[model samples]
Target: MGRIALAELSKYLLDGHLSRRGCLGARRVVTRPVAAGWMLPRAGPVRAFHAAPGSTTTATASQGPAVPLRKQLKDKAKQAKKQGKKKSKADSQTVDGWELTVGIEIHAQLNTSRKLFSSATTSFNEEPNSHVALFDVAMPGSQPLLQQETLLPAIRAALSLNCDIQRVSRFDRKHYFWWDQPSGYQITQYYEPFAKNGHITLYARDGISPEDGESVTVGIKQVQLEQDTAKTLVQTGNTHWLDFNRVGVPLIEIITDPDIHHPRTAAVFVRKMQLLLNTVDTCVSGMETGGLRADVNVSVRKTDDPVRKLGTRTEIKNLSTIKAVEDAIIAERGRQIRELETGGVIVGETRGWTLGSKETRRLRGKEGEVDYRYMPDPDIAPLVIGDDLVKHLQNSLAVLPDAELDRLISEFGLTPKDALSLITLDNGARVQYFYRVLDSIHEQVQAEFAASTPPDLKSYSTLVGNWIIHELGRVTTYKAGPLASGELSFTADGECAQVSGSDLSQLLYHLYRKHITGKVAKELLLAAYLDELEGGVLEAIETNDLWFKEISPEEYSVLADKAMAGEEKVLQEFADYIKFPQGKLMYLVGKMMRLGPTERIDPAAAENVMRARVEGIRAP
Candidate 1:
């Protein structure tokens, strides 16, 4: 009876879906395939999720709703910087000798210009049901035509995660009744998924983490392609509204084994997955907008039980953010333990992470595989890939985050902490910016040195990295919006800035050749990033009289003599050998630095000369 009613509704939609009386809109929606399925949007005003159909509203994309998830994150970061991570309720907490275990199933919408089975378009903020096609409406006899373009990201994800791709894969029908699902059934891979048996290791670079080292490898059970359902908007008086725009969109579901032993570790694993997927252009950053989400499976077991049997697990569905995942697991772990201690058995059920109360609310009893009535998708045929296609995908895949972390540390001579910072920020935009500047410098040096005397690029690594990371990044770019969108249109200083690698290279080139002091280099870098310098760093140096004058060894010795004469008390302290500190040496160097052209002196060389002079002093 349910199947008959769903078929009738499909036929009803197919009759005159976009006519004058259609539920979507009065006019047809025109979508250019080139402009379909939003890319990583630049930070601006974006309407995240909609409310009841009437009162229209919007929000700042970086900051979510009233509480503003990103703001909370920024505040947490500040607290962490000062106080360090305090033990939270979720930090490897055990109750009566019981341990918690969690696994995750992530469904990330693939970044594509069109739907998985039809030419219909996909988008973030399109009108309701406007992007719908015949297949999306689930009209009877509408054969599923596989969109070859949709498979690219799926293949890329599997290969990047080290999954074994199945050349021959088939689809299955997952039957369920929901107001949002127009077809009453979803087409997904189940019997033989496209990929399986992979692992993503967390903290792969820095073992400084006291958590699992390489042992924190989250085993990926399978990767399967599936179709997304429609969006249902709830209104006042229990009114329900359906939007078919998301119907039939393609998604690749990655399932992980129950290997995660800590809540924080699970959170890190999800965040790492988001970075990796976004880096490969899978477009999974839409946690707020439903472009990406996860369902976590949580269970607890007695540590002292010799058998070490697993407890009954409950599913926490639809966690959209990293914090939510960690918090939900922590809450559920406590809940399960409490229920068992009170002489109550843990029941298998589907639960929701309530945002308002910050607890997991029981939604319904868990549905078994038999309840879903899984069957072969008769309309869709087995998906097969040629050997050539698989080989090409592997060769052309984007470099994963872990691999890039290793490369930066080994090839570029960056510290592990610095390397991880670069790759994680702005979805690797800092890393990209770093390389762009490096390329400019390398090109500049190639012609200066012969092939036999190829300049040691590694020698300049520290200098280049310091200017980029410290001056340009921390001072300006990161302040623009560190935790939010990395590609902030305007910098924090309210300057519409676009500083190129060549501009930085020019500034560093002068600093490298000792034509400018480090202080002057920093000023140039700051000016360039903010676009305050009109004619670039070179012209600014020329116009502002910022060039450094080389102080001869004899000149340094004279400056040291002046430094000692002015700092009588500090010199006395140095003479007494009591309270003789490194700062006293720097204090004398600072005196000399201010005497002559401050911008022209290298304080380092002056410090060396001043140290020698101070060594010859006596208490008398």
Candidate 2:
């Protein structure tokens, strides 16, 4: 009885004769004048009932349109199934029944003149092991001494991340047997680290959709000072050697909480941190040269679990690039999910990311705290970071990336995207070069407009940014090739060997004032880059005779008259366009340009003069 009434109600709804609310609330429903149905509210469930066929009230099939009830139900079911399939496909990339969590550990080498425990020079690409001191090799009777110069960069890094600096931090010995560490232990801040409880805010890069402009804060577990180990070099076959030159180099390890979920977030966090460290001049932030590296911790867990407890994690060590970090996490997360699906447990272990295969392979079983015996180092004294020192470091802190980005936008009138591109450039020297050129341009303009309306700085900044980033940046790529191939060696200090910021500034000023055309500017830049410009930009323009000459309107009128005198064909062309007022004037201007010699003439002034001459002749 309930099925029959429900069937009748579906038919009414399909025919557009029943409102949803009325159908649900009506105690009795009548499809026809004489037919009746009733809804029964039971203890367990509410049911619908239809009147018997032979009862007092009944309806014939002719009362409504001839539509089959079975077909209606089947169609509704099919539509629902299609919608469900679409939603499921959209979510298919997500780990089935699981969520991902990631944490990162970054090791940034400190920029210092000497090593942390020795006076050996901290230089790269030097003769192998030549920079190693006696103490670096753990010589007998040699003791570890802290480098005071390393403290400022560390303090600045901590403050930049908004970490709480501990006034007194102690060093500890982390004991382990390894070929790289001759001393069989490392000196690091374990029990009392320098800073804790810090965080960095990140934004998605341009391509991402949902979180493109969104902010995500990743927590900093700790930032501690430690010594770097020697690099192990594997020779042919099984023989390996160690280079002690890198040993004892100062390092700051920033450990992050398990706050990252998406692989892109992990990559973005690393990039932001790298930019911050570079801005502070703490490190070069070159992953390829081993100046910075990251260890990523990835895990997965049930998605719907309320507790959101983390599953057992696997650590992928020494991921050297941002792409490597992101790819490693994504690959590891998928691996763990697949393992769980196959009734395999995720083992707690350490792994290495193979760049060639883009997979994580087991390195060793993960070590617990007990595996590495930790104790306070009796030789080195505890570091006491007084308020005076913290205050001094804070004052010395450079403008960080985010703050500089904001300043570039607000003070210089640059768009957010352009400002970010300038500040986050890989080479710090290029960023410095941009500002230097910008300042030079502003100074020249200011001097020129001492007592007049100031030049539009917004326009100047945009112009400078475009030329520097797009033009100069493109021309400077030759240095990346072999120097023996005749490529100019562009120094990392932002100084081009053949051209300087002052020279570029002079050229830009000319371009801004319309003293030179864009084609002439490019020619001058290329000439300057190739060291062909002997006495600088002015001399180059004079020597090449590429300067643009601005003509007075009266002078341009005389020139136009001389060109139209004996040229009959040109006269006929001008007379043919006399019906259109300005056409003849435009023709005269083109003739003037074609007749001009040596230097390029100002087209605007010539156009005005030609129009005045044509109007005077037609006035009578």
Candidate 3:
């Protein structure tokens, strides 16, 4: 496939499905799936800012256009702003001002390797029905045997959320008839839940919150253990194809109090919840992978009403992404507001979010507690949470986000936003990798730089954090398929093998000391991450010739002018800075970055020189 074609494929592959024809018209693709190094072609050497058609100029060659930096890593700042605007317009919808009260129920698949009620393997990649146990298939004689492996992560998750664990909690059956669920009902904590009374502080996020960083505390109603239904992989008019691999998968349903008042804030709250659950190793938190899903309860009330009676709340079901969560609320809010104003009553119903149409369509009237017909499970005994186990899990829990944020900001001198961004990167893997690199820099700087302490140690930390967030961030997270974790290598065993903390420290140390330009440092990161730098960055730079060549300001000016001479559109955009943003100049910069055989010139420095040259030309 072509580079641009493959890049488009890269985008599709991230969504858990790839529908393209086989590579090179061979009608066969390499198994293991094509992934990693999304920006450059799979086999070619990359130039700095390898501009593709339809990509905006000033953005990274991989991802087109620059999005505003967001403190909450999951939520994109620009997207949130635009979505918030839509929400404001939709919610501005009443004769009297209204308030949106939202409560979210999230079902996250547990991290256990096996199913909750049986020893059937829980891997989603397996063949349909291959991993199913007799119990999962609801064989007449088969009985449910609770997996003990399921409880540890659940306990850890509850404790991490600061919930009070119920010593004796029993499971009840939530009766429902569905093709995917082999059993007539799901075993869940209904009459008595295992954890309750916890609260999560949605830290004042820039784009997602009301006030700048003023924290809102949302009460945790309960955290209950449950079994997930099987997946409906394909559906025809009268037939449904099911994947039983997900059958009996362990899940935790976290019910939050109706404290969220805004759509964006609700999304932020869910984002925070995903982090907490993943932090305690409760579940694989990616919604795309069937790791988690959310159902939101939305009700609108008049702001001026002294009694403040909430309208009939409609449930929006099966929201798969954080963005969808926010959007569903916004859509439903608009629907309800429009209906109420038009003299139609707000009826309680279960609605499904349609992604294509971007609207909430009614599935059925809401199923009440009586409708579920909850009954205590006869097979599974009461869930007894021993104090000893709870205490042990409390002690063993990994540092939660709030405490970590405090440490990173106070001790490390990192800005709160930067610290949160660092920790939240790629499910906190980047933070671990970042800490290792930062700590290594602390020790290695003295020997490498020949100074006890650098003049501006704080700048070094900030620089390191930025690289991890920006460049390394782009390499690891730009693509959607097969997430690149802490280490940036394809080595077998896949630990911190090819590009460890020491390697990054060494590369950043060189870049920090002005031994190499930013372009050189980035190229080295790509090389090291892709395992092209076999003997580590130091050895490669020492033994191998430096791939990047530094050019002077005047040379950069000449290249910038050469790039701009023939491109009238870009030049015109440059001439009119107000009309064109950081967009058109990207092509000019990309041309300059690719001036040499390899990506050698520093983009930051080159861009500055190019801008100066553009100014000089326009200055009449």
Q: What are the lDDT figures for the candidates, one per model?
A: 0.75, 0.77, 0.75
> What global local distance difference test value does model 1 have?
0.75
The candidate scoring highest on TM-score is 1
> What order do you get sorting by TM-score, best first?
1, 2, 3
Worst ten-residue run, lDDT, model 2? Answer: 37-46
Q: Once superposed on the true structure, which residue ranges of model 3 sit more than 4 Å away at CA? A: 1-96, 211-213, 235-237, 447-457, 473-498, 529-536, 539-620
Query: Which residue runs of candidate 1 sit more than 4 Å off their true CA positions?
Result: 1-86, 89-96, 204-209, 284-289, 354-358, 446-456, 474-497, 530-532, 562-588, 591-597, 611-620
State the TM-score for model 3: 0.70
True-vs-predicted CA distance for residue 312, candidate 2, Å: 1.4
Supply the TM-score for candidate 2: 0.71
Number of the top-ranking candidate, with lDDT as the measure: 2
lDDT of 3 by residue, 349-430 (tens): 9999977566799999899999999999998888787889888888888899888888877777788788888777667777
**Over 4 Å off, model 2:** 1-97, 133-135, 139-141, 205-209, 477-494, 549-620
**Could you tell me the lDDT of residue 394 within candidate 2?**
84
